[model samples]
Target: MTDDTIKEVLKRIPYGFYAITSRSGDDVNAMVANWVMQTSFSPRQVALGLEKVSYTYGLIEKGGVFAINIFLKDGADALKPFMKGRSKNPDKMKDIQYSEGPETGSPILESAAAYLECRVVRIVDTGGDHDTVIGGVVAAGVSSPGEVGDTLSLPDLGWSYAG
Candidate 1:
């Protein structure tokens, strides 16, 4: 599918919004993605499909771990700025405001509804601009109430994906 069509299809797939994060040395990166999902329950695996060019992807490849913070609708306004921008900026995490993950160096946004710390178990090239990263969850917990702000969805917001 073309990038537009692929994004359109993906939009139909309901997803919990998340800011997946990773780091390499002082280079910390975080990207907002809606394509992440849990792939397994027995071993507690989660799959995150991120573009090959993402800074977070490089960090996961080099550092071997990643963290995910499922965002809440209440904070959607807080996350809109970082949704579509080059991640080379060292201060990309500035607006994000977070603490380091306990197990991984990944940044954990305190505003998230829930968070998960994971180690890469496999990385597969999904033949598009994105790679399918399957990881095993080491730790996970809900920071706020066991519920998200508003369960934001694409249809609910009427946004067209271009990034």
Candidate 2:
């Protein structure tokens, strides 16, 4: 298949947009991420495809924990500040309102409808630009009740991260 064809197919896969937060001691960060999904049910695990060189990746690596902040469709605007990488928006988390997750101590965005705290179980080198971080869910909370259909997604913001 051609590159354009591959891009088209990759972009066709649905993805949800989220603010992924990480912390290592005094350092903290939040970034926009779409490559997140649950990988297991028994132990409750989730995987995140994180750029190997990203600032958040370093924090997650050093701290061994992270949090996934899930927003509602109406909360799409809340994630805009994190759309930029740390190099372009170094202070993105400076003024953001958030609370520390009880288990991981990662930031949980105040505007999030729900949040999941996870502890790093493994970081796999996939021979790609991104590494797959497998985390076991340690804690979770729902500040605002909602169904899966009420969550915000990449398409809802007219953005694409695949292909």
Candidate 3:
């Protein structure tokens, strides 16, 4: 299949959207990402894909930990600033309102439906523009309990990776 066709096919695969947060001392960042997944269950593990150029990548590298916040459908609007790279401003997260998770200093949005705190176990070079950040799940919680009405994931909203 052609690369474009392959991308289109990949686009059809449903995935959830998450705000991956991390901090390195004073350097903190979050990215609106859809390419994350739970890869193992024995000890529990989740992986996130971060672009080499993203601010969140540096924070994850230095902090060695990260948090993933599963935003509610209405909460997705909060991601607009970060998606535009305006998260560089220290006060960017102020509007989101969050509480620190027990496992890390990374902010977990108070509005998120659930959260996962992870410690980096390994990072594999995806050999192109992004790095696959594999982290061991150290902590997790669901603030809003439900089998329905969480939020629409990337594919559910027909999102594509343009950045």
TM-score of every model versus the real structure = 0.83, 0.97, 0.88
Clashes of 1: 0
What is the alpha-carbon RMSD of candidate 2 to the true structure? 0.8
- RMSD (Cα, Å) for all candidates, in order, is 3.1, 0.8, 2.3
Model 2 residue 20 CA deviation in Å: 0.3
Best by lDDT: 2
Clashing pairs in 2: none
Candidate 1 RMSD to the real structure: 3.1
Which residue segments of model 3 deviate by more than 4 Å?
A: 86-91
Indicate the residue-level lDDT of 66 in model 3. 93
Off by over 4 Å in 2: none
TM-score of structure candidate 1? 0.83
Error of 2 at 54 (Å): 0.8
Question: Residues 80-129, candidate 2, lDDT per residue (tens digit)?
Answer: 89989899898898889999999989999999999999999999999999
As for candidate 1, its clashing pairs are none
Residues 1-163 of candidate 3: C-alpha lDDT, one tens digit per residue? 7888877776667777888888777666677888898899978988888888887887888899999888776666767756755345656665667777787878787767888999999988979798999999999989876554566477556577643
| lDDT ranking of the models | 2, 3, 1
